[model samples]
Target: MKYIVKLNFEVDGSVDKPDVIGAIFGQTENLFGQEFDLRELQDKGRLGRIIVDIKNKGGKIEGYIEIPSNLDRVETVLIASMVESVEKVGPYNAKFELKEIEDVRAEKLKKIIDRAKEILTTWTKEKNLDIKEVINEISGAVKTGEIIEFGPERLPAGPDVYSDPNLIIVEGRADIINLLRYGYKNTVAVEGASGKIPHSVVELSKSKKTVIAFLDGDHGGDMILKDLINANVKIDFVARAPVGREVEELTGKEIAKSLSNMVPFSQYLKKQQESTISVQPRVESVITEAKEQQAVQVIEQPRKEIEIKIPSTVMEEIKKLPGTLEGIIFDETWNPVERVQVRDIISKLETITNGNASFIIFDGVITQRLLELAASKNVKLVVGVRIGGINKKPENVKILTLADVIGP
Candidate 1:
């Protein structure tokens, strides 16, 4: 019973709503006879009023007419056609066009359906979902993706460890992951104290950048620090978690506090030594002299060479990598494990664990510190474009040059 007629009209001169309505009634009268007259239908409540909206612009009026009807479909169509027959309104020559005839009940039903769909979508989302938990899961996945492996041992490390100017060495992969979660990207893990210090870490320390040993607050952390020192890894600073706390479990504020409280490695070591034993004044002098002699000898000695066979595939990769500033790590079976930038090779090595790489071919100079690191990781062969001045070469590691493999 509910029907809406949409009519569009244009008039040559300004006209108001009363003017438009009066014209429709006056023109349509008697044409349909008195039985279907709009005035009689409206008076008896069989039809609603005719509504007109008009706007005057540049001396021309344009607007729409809305007529709600309770008449049958046939009567409604006839009345709409009559409305289009309106040729003049007030003093303006005008033309009316029937835009559409819509069933208001159908539109109301459509709205109900649309609202139901919206409610269902909201309910489904809330059925078994926690907004905070979903966010945490996504964030955790992103953090995990940022972790990478380094060296033959497959040490776990953060991506920024290689790119950042400074580094923080933690005790294990968990500590590295925790630091990464808190937005600390320049972090690597030593894994454990059972094996030698990873060659990647040793070589990285020799780059003369500040390296912090951030360890747990227990006896094990102290042991790890001692082991790193014994292996000749150059640690610049030491940061420790609060007593009874591990690096992996520290809160963000605690982590910041611990790093801020870091002490110089030399100062910390001297303090520890003083607390345990009486020091002779000459001990410092002797240590200083020994360090100076070691530095001098490294510069003066000729690099020793050992005969080692190079695989053809490794040689091919090395050839492709030269001038690219890249390094390729190969597994025990001579398969490529990872390729990294030469500047990041040390940090990359410190991250891998589980004997992930057995050989490394690079387009760079092989330094003494790199040789020691490669040996500690049990990497068997090191191939590069050239060898730098090496004070001493570690056993079990064979160094080769591109000239050595290709035969100058």
Candidate 2:
């Protein structure tokens, strides 16, 4: 069908779905003549079966209706208007309101376009050449000249490992590949055959201007870095993926952020020391004591930063507002009421009826003027990216920063 007319209806008294359907056909009949009659159109195969869904609430019947049509927009609108003119269902008074006229073909076209893109992506992943081969072909370099295998251990690495002044060490081959895709060629994985630090890696680290240990955000990564330290590898800086995340799965933006936020080895060690929980010595055995300490540290340190519990609906709005410089107003039930640019938040607040807006979330700073206006509107909470200078605090309104809601 080319179009589907959708409507909502209410009956003063309880009624069945069949009653509503009968009323739509009986009342709208003869008004538009025989050619436009629903039954006549159905007989000619130009109209599909009328569908009704209804529910009884407190002796009142309310529901939705859908009527498929192959007619043009004007005819489809007329059909909707005829249905909306329905005033009675059985012996009770009723009201029907037009909701929308959905174009079936347009929706199908959108789905087809999405599916085509997905198929193209899957095919490209399956048929594309290896990363090294593709890079070699593009550079017009010999196969052996761009060799990514490094050291006697034959570890997976990028081609510029020897030429680049800086080096980045990761957990496995996949991490190196991920970095290479983002144009970082001085990456090498420390995954040796026996899971030990390779001697070539130590020597290469000593030769580089700066050596950075970029590992995953897990216990295994910590153990690997400890092993590297025990092997006497020269690591000048330390970078880690987000908590519970692996370097191999990070995007280019994430990789760049991790590298840019890297801390000096000494500072990283200090932070780790501060976060570690103290454990009393155990007399059973040294190994037993060490295992207890490791487990205690992991349990004591929470992966996420301190955050407040927010309704999922509110959280979703907060996630989208960042970087958009937009502000959203929510009702007391946490449903979004209005969305406007940050600069227009004051004007939007003025337009809202008092007590209707309960929450305000925005990308910009929370200033005193906003708090005063929000307080007058009886807003319960105001959350912003940051808080600005404020002389007076409102009693009814609770303020919070964006960081107070999201966790790292």
Candidate 2, which ten residues in sequence have the lowest lDDT sum?
A: 277-286
lDDT of candidate 1?
0.76
Report lDDT (Cα) of residue 357, candidate 2: 96
lDDT of each: 0.76, 0.77
Candidate 2 lDDT over residue span 124-202, tens digit each: 9989866754663354223223338899988878898988899998866646655765678888888622236988998
lDDT of 1 by residue, 1-408 (tens): 489989999999987888889999999998979988999999988788788888889989999988899988899999999989989998779999999999999999999999999999998986967564456435643676688887666777889877888989987665765677678889888876443688888887788678999977754465567668767888899999887456765656789999999999888868767787322333344345446755765674446334456677666666675445468888888888888856568778888783777888875657666787788888888987655435566757777876677643
Task: Please provide the root mean square deviation of candidate 2 (C-alpha atoms, Å).
Answer: 22.5
Error of 2 at 231 (Å): 11
- lDDT for model 2: 0.77
The residue ranges of model 2 lying beyond 4 angstroms of the native Cα positions read 116-408
RMSD of model 1 against the true structure: 22.6
TM-scores for all candidates: the values are 0.35, 0.39
